[model samples]
Target: MKKLNKNQVYGFIAIAVLSLGVVGCKATSSVEKTEDKTVPEMFAGATKDTLNSGVISWKTYFKDAYLQSLIETALKNNQELNITMQEIEISKSEIKARNGEYLPFVGVGAGASVDKVARFTNIGAMEATTEIKPGKEMPEPLKDFKLGVYANWEIDIWKKLRNGKKAAVNRYLSSVEGKNFMVTNLVAEIANSYYELLALDNQLEIINQNIEIQSNALEIVKIQKDAARVTELAVKKFEAEVFKTKSLQFEVLQKIVETENRINFLVGRYPQHVDRSTGTFNDMVPNVVSAGIPSQLLSNRPDIRQAEFELAASKLDVKSAKARFYPSLGISAGIGYRAFDPGYLFKPESLLYSIAGDLMAPLINRNAIKASYNTANAKQIQAVYKYEQTILNSYIEVANQVSKISNLEKSYSLRTKQVEALTNSVSISNELFRSARADYMEVLLTQRDALESKFDLVDTKMQQLNAMVNIYRALGGGWN
Candidate 1:
């Protein structure tokens, strides 16, 4: 390192210290509060510097090809999401328009007019000429036609209009964040629905398999009854059991169709068969999440970021509203040429130019200003609460999904064992009934238990997968 002059070294130290203080102040100011409030708690934890602060691309986060296609379609064609995107564009335009109001506006213009002042009027009485031009007499009343280049601008004396423009920019940024949040939710929703369709498809397949098995059992019972091996009662019981299971198959079929349509609707298309591989739902190892810290939620959640932007915007809005109490300044200017005779219209004496400045402030009866100020204050308060609520809700969702993931894992294991036991019991009961050692009711009950256990197993697995998807969404990972 090269040695610096003593004074230069001190100056560098001073700047370094100033930068440190600025950064420290920013960190403190951004930290609204602190609590490792898990997802179940009422408020959002602080945004951590680490949560999704790593700039990762969203497309890379979700690598599923089918899911990627659905998200792409939704981004392109989903009505509500597209509308929100347009709203973001509109907000940006408002920022531009507000900025223009602070700067000078210039435009071109043209017009033609024949004006005849009434002889009884003051302007007419003061005229030097009492007679009209030889071949170009003035028309009755005033037919005035004029055209010129004009410009107007509001001078930002108190920085009021400039602040308004900045406020508009803040709102525009908030709208963009809002769209980002929508996208996060949209992508997660499509993934969840797609998984659900796969789960339903698996469920239908299971139900069909169970129905076939039950039908075979029914056939066995009919053969034994015909030979007087069991009785007519056992045959009827088996037939009823088969019919009950077959009824369940229809319910699962309906769910599969409905779930597919739901996915199609999200893809922004008509209800139709959804093409998907059920293998993903079964074999897809859900992404392992690092719940780094409770404070990390602020940065990880889109809703929370959105709420922060709205809070900033609301604060700016309040400032803009307060500015209404002060005076406003405006300036306008125009330049052109005009004359009664067309030949003299461009002459130097015919040159017309004017510039003016206006200062306006509310003196009395300022109900509109007062109302605006009051409304701004009300909205500010509302924004504060909404921000708080969004934080709380995001944390809650994360916590629930995290907890659900753990619990569902355990539930699924138990259901798996339950299915095995019930399946064995069915075999044992059927063998005993054949020897007239067990009652018909025992076989029917055993078969029902086995069916229920299998269904429960599938349901538990669905919850596990759904929890993983939801937790990732709550963590704001997908939108990144």
Candidate 2:
């Protein structure tokens, strides 16, 4: 065998080193440039207080027992949430797979094979001249049997496999955060729908009460018309108002049914009556919400945290991709027994073992690797944008809900006063009409206005409750 001289070996080593350097520089240059955007420390026009509602648990944040029960059920039975949990599991499996890539793969197996060679071939002539025993000739057909354990491993000199494993871990964590975000949304939706159901119930009650009042007014107007005190047109007008209110009653009823079914769907159950408090809807008040500093969203909001994890994973992916442009070292080994006869397979004379290694690098047709590196860099940039977007969205949601809660409170107060004044006018107008101090038209208009004001008050109250629920979710309260 010819051996390489010292100078030739040194020159080869130098060429390899220079090639690696060029590839490393090229890999670095392949990374795309992107703008650096920093997250804001506080929301615009927000107070500096750190007392956020996000720290509160959903159980404590929502005071209603029925709402708490519904949220619990949804968390356990919701299909989308279950699917997210499975994604988390899949990410965990990916971590295991990536980890295995860096570690040695070992396997044990046994096999048998038969081979027949041509008599005129070189191997056949050699076999015909050789003898396994003094008086025995080589077999015409060869039979091989082996039992062995083998191992193969890739040396992560560039930390490629390690970085890939780390990326998988980050993705697993991101999937978990995604599930938490889903929980927050699911809880908020059920709460808002529950409040809406309560509002619809109140409206239905108001309509029923108005129907009775208008029916009595209609009877009064009919008697007055017969006595020649009021015109027939007045009686017809009163009857028409009663009919309109009765129709509204059905509309509100339909809404209640739809809301209840929506709640059932969220809870992952068949359509059924949802349990809720209908009597105290008018007396219900929204919980006080606290908007903390915007920076808290980075830690508290699930979507933001999820995006942060994805960004981390993407950065690791870029590193792994860049490593692909560098040389990879791999080693393989096997130890086994082999023989032409199965009876000799376990003998020490038939034992065989081998070990080998390889160093491989991409020198040509590297467009695929370069594209992968660029794509990874692009995804990293996208993750950064998504993370920042999540933060901005969280802050805006909280800010909007804070403002909505404040405005809803003021509106509720005004609606209460309006309801009180209109309610008084309704009774006063009825007495005046009976006493001939006012016309039937005035009584009819007062009752209709009073009913509408009451309905509006219920709606405002519902908005307040919905805003409270939304702010809690926006603050990332429910998933903990």
Candidate 3:
């Protein structure tokens, strides 16, 4: 046997150490750009002393029992929301896969194979001359059987696999926030539609009452014509007005049907009557909303939080991609039994085992890795932009709803007085016409104005309620 001398052995060790140092020096870049994290102290000049409505639970926020029920049903059954839940599950599975990438993978397996060699080959001639035992010849064909447990693992020296798993975790949390945002919207939609249905019911009742009033006026005009106090044209005008009111009643009924169906759709059910308080629509007042500081939106709004998670995930993805440019160390091992025949597979003489490791690095044609790293960086930037946009949008939505609620309150008050005056005028005009003290045209106009004012009052009230629901949603309520 030959062996190396001490000097040669020292030189070999030095070369091995230099080789490790060269391979361990990664070429990946670690430069990351800064992101904006600024937010206003207040939203639409709101004071910081007020409490944010978003922290309130949906059950406490929505006082209407029917509306609360609808929201609950939607959260449980809405197709879009269910789909978002599935996406969350998928993200969770991705986390598992990434975690597995950095952990040892172990498995057991068994296999059998047969091999044949030609007599004219070198191995065939040697086999013909060989003897397995003193008087036995080697077999013409070989049969192999094996059974083993094997394992492979990639050492995450640079935290690449760990970062990938963290990214998946972030994405999973983002999906949860996405579902919460959807809940907010769904609750708002159902409430809005429910209020609209109530408004339509009120409008329909108003139209029907107006139609009866016009019919009586028509009767009076016909009586006046019979007495030669008015011409046929006046009677015909009153009759046409009655027909118009009846037609309007049908239109309002159609709206009611559509609104009910819309609510049913939101609740993920078939079209049917939506339970609501139709008579109380006029008495329904908008809920008082308190706007907290704009900075609170970071924690209050689900979309904002979702964007935040997505940004975090993207940042982690960039780290994982950058790590790809460095060398990766992998180890594999197997313990097994192998023999030329199945009878000998489990014997101690057939026992076999092996272990190996490799260090791999991109030394040539690294365009693919560079592109992936660049793409990860770009996505991180995009996530930052999206995060900022979500915050901006949340602030604007709350501000707009706040203004809308204030304006609607004033408008509704004015409309109430207008309705009262027109209603009185309607009665006065009818009495004057009956006594031949006012023109038939004046009576008709007063009745029409009064009916319209009543409808407007209902519509304004509906707007007030809708504004309240929207503000709650904007503040990220109904998702807790």
Per-residue lDDT for 365-464 in model 2, tens only? 8999988998898898888778777777877898888788878888899999999999999999999999999998899889989998998999899989
Q: Against the correct fold, how does model 3 do in TM-score?
A: 0.93
**Residue 42 CA error for candidate 3 (Å)?**
1.8
What is the TM-score of each predicted model, taking all chains together? 0.82, 0.95, 0.93
Enumerate residue pairs that collide in model 3. none
Q: Which structure among the candidates has the greatest lDDT?
A: 2
- lDDT, candidate 1, 20-50, per-residue tens: 4443222111112322223432223332334
Q: lDDT by residue for model 3 over 391-474, one digit each (tens)?
A: 888889988988898888899999999999999999999899989999999999999889989988999999998998998999
After superposition, the stretches of candidate 2 with alpha carbons farther than 4 Å from their true spots are 1-14, 17-21, 28-47
Count of clashes in candidate 2: 0
Per-residue lDDT for 431 in model 2?
Answer: 94
lDDT of 1 at 289: 51
TM match of model 2 to true structure = 0.95
Q: What's the lDDT of the predicted structure labeled candidate 2?
A: 0.88
